[model samples]
Target: MATDDLVVPEAAGAQYRETMPSFAQERFWFLDGLVPGNAAHTLQQSYTIVGPLDVTALADALTAVVRRHDVLRSRYVPAEDEVRVQVDAPRPVDLPVLDLSTEP
Candidate 1:
């Protein structure tokens, strides 16, 4: 039999509401100010596909994901004494595809 579906918890309130940064975000902001160009707070991910891939379709898929998720297009703006979260309008995601298939 199939296992029970995982229950995903939702945020307690409305979506895209104006709000200030959390403690962690505040700390990251301060640390970023102290150490510019630090990769400590950055997250990197990679995936490999062994079959034929459509570059345009992949870009469209990524753009669709950004359109559906507000956080993907969010930016931090400095306020009076703290930083505020600002959600930007979803736009086309510029995904550059490099053709390295000829490399041996």
Candidate 2:
């Protein structure tokens, strides 16, 4: 989930509420090894950072990062509704960009 900002309130039970700095968060999920005749196990990773960012630059950087890392380009095939990892092409993908910015 990508959001412009995330505010966490301090002193929830107290009469006064203070809003702290917002953060940008990124989430990733990975599934590996099926259970004996069952579904595969999954691994999830999430990251949060606090600051202003250029979305386009960030996306480009993320693409470069993914390209640099072999895992992101890996593919998976479905087996009985469960996905199994497969070796895939290392080529970078041209993902469609969502226009979050309005024209000047």
Candidate 3:
């Protein structure tokens, strides 16, 4: 297939808006995979911070977030390395905690 044919559906446009809840009232976060020559593939996560949250709960919620979105759980097919979106068990993601209290 031609290089152009390898392009996946654009998930950052108006079409995606239709699939997302109102950002004003809901907390939505995006996770993207590293795909060369393509725009950042985003996965929308439904998240809420209730008082003080635990690390385990944070991990669980992040996993749940990936589970809730097909793109985040997808893997690239072999051969031509074509992108394929799928529904599967949640993959573990190591998220780094950053301290942003320091001024730049």
Candidate 4:
């Protein structure tokens, strides 16, 4: 069975727009239905940098990187024949507050 057959078709009135997925991205798109999104198919890394933390700077740097790489902020749509990828310009992302200071 093809991946497209697994996904529900879009609405008739819905606007359809997307770019063709790269070869690498296409491989993953085909496996999307076969494999779970939460499952690990690639290497995983955990990082812990100890120092006077600069959250603001870290977030800013990440935002800049996102703006530079379209793939980082792109959306994917699977079609019967091919996979579609769309990218929109990056915008400011607000960080939510989480105070764990009281936790033991």
Model 1, TM vs. native: 0.64
User: What are the models' TM-scores?
Assistant: 0.64, 0.34, 0.35, 0.66
Q: Using lDDT as the measure, which candidate wins?
A: 1
List the lowest-lDDT window of 10 residues for candidate 1.
1-10
Count of clashing pairs, candidate 2: 0
Clash tally for model 3: 0
Candidate 2 on 49-102: residue-level lDDT in tens?
556657667667777887686456544445554343343334444656555446
- Candidate 4 lDDT over residue span 18-81, tens digit each: 4566778878877876775845566678986765667788788888888888787778876677
Reference-based lDDT, residue 6, model 2: 31
Model 3 misplaced regions, further than 4 Å: 1-36, 40-56, 78-89
Model 3 pairs in collision: none
| Decreasing TM-score order of the candidates | 4, 1, 3, 2
- List, residue by residue over 27-78, the lDDT tens digit for candidate 3: 2121222334444444467875556657777788887888687556544332
Between candidates 1 and 3, the lDDT winner: 1
Q: Which runs of model 1 end up more than 4 angstroms from their true locations?
A: 1-19
Q: Between 1 and 2, whose lDDT is larger?
A: 1
C-alpha root-mean-square deviation, each candidate: 9.1, 19.7, 13.8, 7.6
Any idea what lDDT model 1 has?
0.73
Error of 4 at 60 (Å): 0.5
